[model samples]
Target: MDISINYTRGQDDPKSGPVKVGWVVSDVEAPVIYDPPRRVNSRDARREHGKSASRCPAVLGLESRYFEIACPFDINIGFDRDKDGRPHLRNLAGTSGPIRASTLGKRLSITNEAEWRYPDRPIIQLKLPYIFLADEPTYITQLDAYLHYRKTPLPGTIFGGRFPINLWPRPLMWAFEWHDVSKPITLRRGDPLFYCQFEFDNPERSVQLIEASMTPELKSYLEHISSAVNYVNQTFSLFDAAKRVRPQTLITPARS
Candidate 1:
C-alpha cells in the first residue's frame, strides 16, 4: 500500500525524482512520520527465562510505524470564560527561534458550538498539514490520528478525537478537550503533539509512505469537502461530501 501525502504549502512538482522512501514536493517542510520510540528495558524488570514485552508482537506493532506530530513552536494555551460561562481559549507565543511559526499557522482556537460535549470547557483545534491517499484497490487499511496523551499523561485533558483517514482526504485538524481551565498549559517546540497510526485490514500487503505532490483536481476536491463542515452540523459526516464533490471517474475503487 502506497499512501501519498501532500500539504497545503507543498509544491506541485519536483524535478528531482522521488524521495528515497517517499517523495514530498514541499518548499517549506514535508510532513514527517516517525517510528515511535520505546523505552529501554531496565535490567531489574527482566526475567531471565520468560518472554518479555520487549519481544511481544503487539507491543512492537504499536511502536513500529506512526506519524509523531510535534508542536510547531513554543506556545502557551490559556482559558477564559464570559459572564455566561461560555469558554474561550487563548494562545501566546513563547520564546521562538529565528524562524518563527506563522501567526496564523500556530493559532489554536476553541470550538464555537454551544451544545457540544463539555461546552463550558475549552476544545482547542491544532490544524495539521498532510492529506493522504492510498493507491491500492484490492486491499483495505485504516489511519487513525489522536493525541499521544496516554504516553504523556497530562491530567484533566482529553485527546478529543480519532479520525479514520482512509475514507477522506481531510487535513488532520486535531481537537484537544481541556477539562481544567485552572492554569495554562505550555508546549515547547518539538513537544510531541499526536500520533497517526495506520492499520491493516489485509495484513499481508506491505505499506509504504510515499511523498507525493497534490494534484490540482484533488486539492480542489479537498477544499470543497473541508469547507462543507462550515455549513453543516455533523462535521464527521463530510466523508460523503468528499465523494459527492469528486467526479466519479476520478475515484479509485477500494476493497468494499
Candidate 2:
C-alpha cells in the first residue's frame, strides 16, 4: 500500500499544513549482526540455535510502544469515535509509526510483502497504541542466553505436521513445552493494541495508550519477547539459588 501522511514536529493539528519526516529501516541499512547459527547436531546446538535466532534483526530492539488509528487522513485532535463504533489501533508493519486508525490518523496500509525486499517492508496502518519494554534488562537477558549457549550448546528439536488450533491448546505436548520455555502472549484477534508514550520527566511514568491491531510481523516481535522471557527465567533461578546443593548420603566419599 502507498502510505502518505502529513506530520507535524511536536503535536499533530489537521488544520495545519504538511509535516516533514524521515524514516530508517533494515532494508535501507546493512543487516545487524548479533548471533550466528550453529550445527544442529551438536550437544549444545539447541542453546546455540536459540542464541543465533535471537540475534537476528527480527529479534533485537524488539520492544517499543506502537499506536493505531482508523483514518489515514488528518488526525482529529479532540474528535473520538462513538462508544458504539468500536474504534481501534496498531503499527506500520516494519517501521515504527504512531497509532493509526481506520478512519483517521496517518493514512497507511500494507501491500504485498514481496514488494519491499530491497527498500524494506512497508508500514501497516495501526488503530491503537501499546507499550513494549525493549530496554537494557531485555537486552541483558538475550546476552546471557547467548553466552550460555556459546559455552554449552545442546541439540535442538523441531516438530512438523498439521493440527487444530484453539484459543488454548495442549497444556503439555511439544508445542506447550516449547512455548513454556518462551511462550508467546498476544492480544486476542479483536482486542485493540496500542502505542505507549513515555514521559522523559518521569521515566517510570506511563503515557497515554491508543488502540490498534496486532499484525503478523509484529507477532514475530512478541515471539522474540517470549524467548527473552525464557532466557531470563532459565538463567536466573532464584528458587534454585536459595537452596544449597547437598551430596547424597548413599554416596560415600572415596578418599585415600
Candidate No. with top TM-score: 1
Best by lDDT: 1
Task: Point out the worst 10-residue segment of candidate 1 by lDDT.
Answer: 15-24
lDDT of 2 by residue, 1-256 (tens): 9696533333353223221111111121111321111211223333446457544544333322222211112221211124774222232221332323533333223323354333332322222221222111111010111222223221222122121111101111111011121222222222212211222222322222212223343333333333343356442342233112211111111232
lDDT of 1 by residue, 220-247 (tens): 6656666665688877676665545664
Positional deviation of residue 232's Cα in model 2 after best superposition, in angstroms:
3.1
> What is the number of residue pairs that collide in model 1?
1
Single out the weakest 10-residue window by summed lDDT for candidate 2: 168-177
TM-score of 1: 0.61
Instruction: Note the Cα lDDT for every prediction shown.
Output: 0.49, 0.23
Candidate 2 accuracy as TM-score: 0.16
Assess candidate 1 and give its lDDT. Answer: 0.49
